[model samples]
Target: MAREKRTEQLFVTVPSFFRCPISMDVMKSPVSLCTGVTYDRSSIEKWLALGHNTCPATMQTLPSTNTTPNLTLRRLIHLWISQADITPAISKQEAADVINGEFDSNSLTKMIGFINSSEENLKFVALSNHAVPKLVEAFAKSDSMRVLELIVEVLDLISMENAVREKLNELILKSDGITDYLSSFNLVLQKGNTESKVKSARILELMAVNSDSQRKIAEKAGLLHELYSLCSVETETSAVEAGLSALLAISTSRSVKKELIRFGMVKTVGKILSGYDYSSAVRAVIEKSLKMLEMVATCTEGRGAISEDRECVVEIVKRLMKCSRAATEHGITVLWSVCCLARDGTAQENVAKVNGFTRVLLVMQSDCSSNTRLMCGELVKVLREKNMKSNLAPYETKTTHITPY
Candidate 1:
């Protein structure tokens, strides 16, 4: 007799539950996971051990686990083997076409390319009238940011239906949604198209609403400087307001605020007083910038004491005094901080730089805003107490508070 080769038969290949039917890729979580292939070897063994033969794949309801031996049982076994061979490449496309073209479930593939490569374009082109559940599975498994941007627009174009927007939002949340694009966000905002700018602003503001860590990630990703420049310069009031709001968020973050200061933002603040056309907005920024400056002034690590910073403040105050009355509430604030710090560090001679502090005394005496007036009064009191020949405001007992915001 010929020697018989001894070999073991192979077990069925059962894949993980996440494999996409369309693309055959492993699934990313938080998507539609289909239930299919299982690996309960114990269950299969239990079914077979009873000896009434049956195919587990068919899951047919039958009476006996053991069978009387016959060619019919052999034929059934042959059919089972044939079906197993067909399953991997089986009628999948026909199934996809049926759902996508008939049910309208499968969305168009989102376009993603350089410039034209956005997600919305692809979604439009690939969208079908039918429900391609597998194609949606394909999208879920292979998420690309380019696809999501497209979906956002597609949702909007389809009248922003709740289901679509919610779906898009889910996609966004899953992708952690482009929080790093903050580096280019302002350039997007500065585009000539008003609608585009508004949309960009809204997108950025929404990201800011996430947790403190998410917000910090956005700032580190480059939002702080871009928004700071836009807040003072954008012609559109809405854009400016939005930028200011972004700045406020940035200021609230201690670490982010420190980063902004280290990035040479102090000079940027110093420059805002003159270049911006909206005096009201400009003044608001001037006040904000000074508040930041005072914090810097109090910092212990510096060669200039408060005095060097005071010189910069004196210069701005002198410039404002030329058309000083036209300055907004925030402008007076810069003056107030300047004068307050000057009182702490300056002498009789440097006060000569702006008319011997006489002009500052005048702003204190006559300015209508109570904070400005009080800050102005405090400067005079400091000067008198320091023995400077300043016949400024007679120091008032009631004007105890000197800081201006």
Candidate 2:
């Protein structure tokens, strides 16, 4: 009986290294920082997301926040779990009970683990078992940031299903639902760390499916400003993309577009376009930035901003036919809005100075869309008309026949 008791104690007590210092839970995905301290990926990510620059375990100042996966440690944890006969799966009823009952960190962690597990059967079971509504109830009632983060993470996972996503949208947009969560979301955006902010922004983007929701989301106090701040070149690429994507979802409203300009969005996008190295930067970010620039340029204020900033205009000209086809189209649209539609002479001159005539001709010759070809034709006409007296030889007009489309 004494021997049996010792075995029981051994099974109950987890090794210190096997647990994350922040959460004290067995590390699901272990990673190490520059200080050589290992932690669970989720916990350490949350710690860094909160803007802490030091190692959590040693409290030592960190040289870098990058985490390397501790593969050997992860393997050991898996082996220990197997040897100890530990099963992480919870029954469907148990999942509903835990979610409906008081917030328990351990139980929530298990649910997250179960949902994120490799077993396809378990994932289907969790979702089929009324997990979405129960979790949404917890999401609405819980005021704890930690609880919100965990719940949001789970919701984000569950949101992959079309049915679950539609249900979540309904719950989020119901009367007073948007109002109640907007405050909480605002708090998260203001004080919660990077990871939390990204998740909240994603949820906001998903919820803004229609004009009413889009307008409401944009009108949220300080929401646009916070999202605008995330578009900085200094921010992580993922965060920047998330911010741009969310803004794009709501930018259909003319008022929202104007508000974004008032927030200095044009200048921010110009800085990102001019400062970021295209080769190293993510393609999606470039496309999104250019797309956002084009959207703002449709309005009077946006066109003025783009045309006034000579560097921004030049940068837009430089990206012609250089990035993806979508980016090229966006770039062309911005130039068209400022030079052709708005008829900004400075923008016209900027295009000519950058040898844009030749670039436009090259795009015209390529298999571009009909609308893009028309824009190029107009751009060529404007550039030629503006620089009629100057030596047109530099623009290679004599060598390449300007196709009159």
Writing each residue's lDDT as its tens digit, candidate 2 over 93-137 gives 676666666654456655766665533523573456467766766
RMSD to the hidden true structure, all candidates: 25.9, 11.4
**lDDT values, one for every candidate:** 0.40, 0.74
lDDT of 1 at 28: 20
Q: TM-score of the candidate numbered 1?
A: 0.40
* lDDT (tens digit, per residue) of candidate 1 on 109-167: 21111112222432433343322233334334433433333322222233122343334
lDDT of candidate 2 at residue 195, scale 0 to 100: 59
Worst 10 residues of 1 by lDDT: 1-10
**Poorest 10 consecutive residues of model 2 by lDDT?**
3-12
